[model samples]
Target: MATHAVRVSGLVRSFGDRNVLDGLDLAIAPGEFVAILGRSGSGKSTLLKAVAGLDYDVTGDGDIAVAGEIAVAFQDSRLLPWLRVVDNVELGVRPGRGTAALAEVGLEGRERAWPSELSGGEQQRVALARCLVREPRVLLADEPFGALDALTRIRMHDLLRELCAKHQPAVLLVTHDVDEAIELADRVVVLHEGRIGLDVPAHDADRTHLLRALGIGVAA
Candidate 1:
């Protein structure tokens, strides 16, 4: 069995007496790609924030430790408009790692281009390259492709899968699109009402079964 890259037990989070995560427990193995699915206000993003140590009010019994640093990609590209693409990617690199990271994301020739000059997909690629430059042990993405159009989103999904495979980071993606999750993740975890409602492998049959379990009708 693969060793766990992240473990959570009894995790609880609240905002003004309204609990968002209640006793959530999960274990993510190294090199695994996991997708988190949930409706609005289901605490999916909150969970990622807590794991990344960006949320200070979370209380949990388990610890999340990565073999290396953790990197996050948010819904927005979060690129610096004043800087060129390569420069933005370089921000996350230690000293001499930016070029390699950009190359890894297939942005070798576009390094000098400004964010405004690139397509939305390309900008998102830049954001991903920034995260990749960190050589993270874990990649936490919160709706990273949410704002893109359908075609662009699909392309980004493929890029993300290829990059994660190449880099071998344990990935946790928060998305509302079930089909996207099924296609990209090794495992799909559904968060409902502040708890884990379903956890299953992402095999075709298993994804169908999970959808059924969640009372979401699968297409005929």
Candidate 2:
């Protein structure tokens, strides 16, 4: 068995003259949660897309490996408007699995609700249910909770931690929020010019150091 749920070697991606990812390498242990922090256009999403095998036109000079199924959740819930909530979760999974997945995300009785009827947080929950229903080995969450309000984001964070513990899938969360990364990730890496500039365990993450690395000044 592979020791890592996801691996990238010598990864490089470019658009026109700019290289978004230049020889970046990363490894995610099975069941470990990692968060990535970077400035806008720092290639955080690009790296996640590469791991999910969703990169095409810009992918160059890299190898990505995964031990099992990979699922992705974006800032947008991306649920099908026409499908009932349960049906959305069941899209790529077995018919009966949606109910269990929805239950896991605290939306058990909402299986019949329409996407239009769900609140923003509820829609994101449905999105998570859809991803978790696949029993994925790796879950790539690209600012999954970025759209939620502060209180809802906090709730979603706790829910995500619980779900990840239960499912034991390696997770890669890309976000701009430093506090969010500290709260959720076992490890956090700051991406600079497509390469990892600072990698540290979240529990001991230095706020000033992280902020400085992102080219932001700490108000000392």
Candidate 3:
């Protein structure tokens, strides 16, 4: 059996009168790639944030053990205007460890360029690089490619898969696009009504069944 990287049981979170997450349970193995799909306001992002330790208000009797550090990449690039592309990517690194980090993201030569000078895709690449530089044990991504065009998004997906294969981090991605989840994740988990609606492996048959269960039509 694989060792669990993150475990959640009976997790609950409430905002005033509304319950965002109620009795949620999830278990993730090390180096697993899991994608979370949900409608708007289903607390998908909330769950990720809580697991990432960004939300302390959550109440749950769960065990989350990350052997390494955790890093997150938000929808926005979140780059500093004053810093160059490489510098932004290096922000997660120590003072002298920037070069190698930038190199890992394939931004070796563009380090000196400013964020504004790069395209949206390049900026997001820098953001991804920043997260990678941390060498995190778990990578939490919240719609990281939401802002890119179709071609760019596909390219980014490939890059992300390559990077994860190389680095071997447990990845949890929250995305609305079902195809994106199918293309990128080894498993797809659907969050509905503050609980896991479906959890299945990404094999051809299973993926088709899961998508149909989610009311998503498979490509004919």
Candidate 4:
């Protein structure tokens, strides 16, 4: 059996009277890339938060097991303005590790620049480097590339794939882009009404069926 990096069984989370995640269950094997596809309010970010151990306010009736350290990259870069780029990436980590991680994310030589000196994409790369410096066993990404332009997003996709292949972390990428999910993940999971609506291999799964599951239909 494959070693699992993340496991959640019978998980539940609520806000007010609405259940954001209701009895959700998931398991991710070590080094597996899982992309979660869903519309707004489908609980994708909530689920990632739960897995990252950032949502302590969540009330659940299940267990979550993660093999090692966790890191999260969100839609916003969230870089500290006053810190230099290297300082941002190395926050709590060794400077050498931050340098290497920045290089891994294709941000080499820009370490001394301030956050304001970089473009949106470059800032995001620094964010990626920061998260990666920890050498996390599981990476929780909540639409990390969503704010970038199309070209930058494509480049980021490639960089992410290369980094994941090299680092071999169990990655859970939460996004609304169908094509992006299929392009990046080994398996694509669709969430609907706060539950697993469909889970299928990204390479050979039927796009039409997946689109239908996501409530997207062909234009007449």
Candidate 5:
């Protein structure tokens, strides 16, 4: 059996004239959280999609291997507007499991709430619940809290950390925010020009270093 929960070897992805991910390689251990950061159009999202198996149709030479189950959460909640909170979480899940998932995300009493009635943060919670209900062994998150207010984002971060600890799923979080990456990930990776430019433990990374890795000027 493979030792890593997720692995990408010799990965290459391109869009017409631009090679978004060129000969990229990444490995994620079980229950480890790795945050991705890069400048705009640096293939951050593209890399996540490739790992999540959404790039199956795209022509690529690399190989991806995953262990157990996979679940994804995007910046947009993507909940069906017509479905109630419980119904959305219950998608493809057994009856009554949605309530338990909601409770896990701190939305216990809001099972009957409509998607329209939820605030942005609450909606994201439901999205998280949807992913958690699957009992995934790998969780792919793409800027999952990017739309929330600062306080709400902090709260969601705490909740997410707790859930990941309990679930112990290897996590790949794609984000542009440096602080967010440092706050959540065991390791921080900066994708530059289609490859991993920097990979370091989060505890050893700082804002200025990360900014420089992304080719941004920092005032000294």
Candidate 6:
């Protein structure tokens, strides 16, 4: 049997009377890349937070297990303004890992630059590098490329694929773009009504089917 990098079983999270995640279950094998798609209030980020163990206060009869370290890259770069590029990546990690991680993400010489000096994409690269420096066993990414322009977003997708291939960490990418999910994920999952509505391989996927699952309909 293949080893799982992350496992969540029977998860239930609620905000007052509303249940964001209800008895959700998922597992990610080592080196697998999975993307999640859902509508605005379908509990996508809430699920990711649960898997990442960021939301401590939850009512659930479930367990989330990660074999090793976990890291998250958010929509915003979230780099400290005062820190230099490399320093941002190095902030809480070991000495040399940051340098190697920066190289891995294709930001080799921009280490000395400040957050304000770099473009949006560059800052994201630094954020990605920061996540990579820890050598996480599972990476939880919440719309890491959603803020960039079209061209830059595409570039970041390619870079992300390359980095994942090299590092081989199980990845869960949460994004609203269906095309982006299809392009990057080994498997794509759609969350509907706070549950796993569809889980399928990315290749030759039915986009309309996924859209419908998310309660979106085609218009004439």
Where does candidate 2 clash, by residue pair?
none
lDDT of each: 0.85, 0.93, 0.83, 0.89, 0.93, 0.89
Off by over 4 Å in 4: none
Worst 10 residues of 2 by lDDT: 53-62
Model 5 spans > 4 angstroms off = none
Candidate 2: misplaced stretches above 4 Å? none
lDDT of 5 at 151: 99
lDDT of 3 by residue, 74-190 (tens): 999999999987778767567655667667666778878999998998888888888887878889999999999999998899899989999888999999888888889988998
State, as a TM-score between 0 and 1, how close model 1 is to the true structure: 0.90
Runs of candidate 3 with Cα error greater than 4 angstroms are 56-64, 204-208, 215-220
Cα miss at 17, model 2 (Å)?
1.6
RMSD of each: 2.3, 0.8, 2.5, 1.5, 1.1, 1.4
Tell me the tens digit of each residue's lDDT in model 4 across 13-74: 88878898888999999999999988788899889998988887866667889999999999
Candidate number that wins on TM-score, 2 or 3: 2
Model 5 lDDT tens row, 57-151: 66667888999899999999999999999999999888889998999999989999999999999999999999988999899999999989999
Superposed model 1: Cα runs more than 4 Å off: 57-63, 204-208, 212-220
Top candidate, metric TM-score: 2
**lDDT at residue 188 of model 4 (Cα atoms):** 96
- Cα lDDT tens digits, model 1, 108-155, are 888889999998888899999999877788899999999999999988
> How would you encode candidate 6's per-residue C-alpha lDDT over 54-76 as one tens digit per residue?
88776665788888989999999
Q: For candidate 5, what is the TM-score? A: 0.97
Q: Model 3 — TM-score against the truth?
A: 0.89
Could you estimate the TM-score for every candidate?
0.90, 0.98, 0.89, 0.95, 0.97, 0.95
Task: Give the number of colliding residue pairs in candidate 4.
Answer: 0
